[model samples]
Target: MPTQNPRVNVVLDNFLYQNVRLLAEKDNVSLSAKVRDLLKEALEIQEDIALSAFAEKREKSWNDSETLTHDDVWS
Candidate 1:
């Protein structure tokens, strides 16, 4: 069974629209479906980049930490 997704209206340049239409025809999917797939793919890529940046920041912060013992603090 197919799922029903929300509908949205978007404006694209003629050239881009034609390209997407051709791609959709080639893939045997509706224009809206192809656009949705592309948008989802782009968002996922952006999410991956953001997560990678966060991980790097955490790694650097962990590496920059300085450990001290109770005696070291007293002295």
Candidate 2:
């Protein structure tokens, strides 16, 4: 059964499809599952990049607020 509306549809070349099919079969999983897992991983990587950028911004703000040098250490 096919869904009326699929979330995604990609067309790969024969070589690419062959590799994906082989790996999916080796893992005993469907091609759809493999694609879904790849999509999930891509989303996670995007989130990680966003989070890293936000953390870097905060660290810069913190560093800018402190103007003490090593010579004035604990003063």
Candidate 3:
């Protein structure tokens, strides 16, 4: 933990903790740093899923993209 950032207490199942510890060792990073990095990535994936769902919901609303011409909007 960095002195600049406040720390929070966390509990994990022993098996889960062991696996995370192994990953930390493998990555040559402190367990806390590894956990923070993993959490950041998980958050990013969640945001991606949400954005993708919104895009998919709107994708078919467009009639034609490839063959679209300027007059499609004005005429």
Candidate 4:
């Protein structure tokens, strides 16, 4: 049978492979699933960090006098 989802092949060091295998066994999921889940989580965290940096940069350059009120935006 063929899988519908895309597949990724990765090469991990022995230590990392062992750790991921252990985690998969603990969670009762396949190694691929465990790696996929971890990748998703890591990407989310990276996105959050990037967003936070952007927000902080925006905050540093914020000007209240040049801002608009809620009515101004709606109307």
Candidate 5:
């Protein structure tokens, strides 16, 4: 079954449109799908960075020792 594609009209500069078209060809995806994929990827990357920052905050609360104790040094 063929799925219906949504219709959207976006205006871009000629150069930008050409670049998008080239990327679409290289990736073997329709321009619309490529744009949607790119947006999703960007959002996911942003979310990952935010989660990593939150993890760093949690890690700092647990581990504060920069210098090793005698036990640690011996072990």
Candidate 6:
């Protein structure tokens, strides 16, 4: 049988491999699933960091006089 999902091959050092294997065993999942979940979590964290930086930059340039009120926006 062949899988329809895309496949990726990664090479991990012995220490990392063992850690991933242990996590998979503890979660009762395959190594691939564990890696996929970890990668997803890492990406989400990266996105959150990027968004926070963007918001901080925008905040630095914010001005109350140049902004609209809630009622103004609704009207």
- Residues 31-66 of candidate 6 have per-residue lDDT tens digits of 999999999999999999999999999999999999
Provide the overall lDDT of each model, using Cα atoms, as 2-decimal numbers.
Answer: 0.92, 0.87, 0.91, 0.98, 0.88, 0.99
Write one digit per residue (lDDT tens) for candidate 1, span 7-41.
Answer: 68899999999999999999999999899999999
Better of 1 and 2 by TM-score: 1
lDDT of 6 at 54: 100
For 1-75, candidate 2 gives per-residue lDDT tens digits of: 877866767999999899889888989999999878777899999999999999999887886457788788967
lDDT of 3 by residue, 29-57 (tens): 99999999999999999999999999998
Error of 6 at 34 (Å): 0.2
Could you tell which candidate, 1 or 5, scores higher by lDDT? 1
- TM-score for predicted model 2 compared with the true structure: 0.67
Residues 1-75 of candidate 4: C-alpha lDDT, one tens digit per residue: 998999889999999999999999999999999999999999999999999999999999999999999999999
| Best-to-worst ranking by TM-score | 6, 4, 3, 1, 2, 5
- Between candidates 2 and 3, the one scoring higher on lDDT is 3
**TM-score of each model, in listed order:** 0.72, 0.67, 0.76, 0.85, 0.61, 0.93
State the TM-score for model 1: 0.72
| Clashing residue pairs for model 3 | none
| Per-residue lDDT of model 5, residues 1-75, tens digit only | 766986668898999889888999999999998878877899999999999999999887875567678899898
lDDT of 2 at 75: 71
- Pitting candidate 1 against candidate 6, the one with the higher TM-score is 6
TM-score quality measure for candidate 4: 0.85
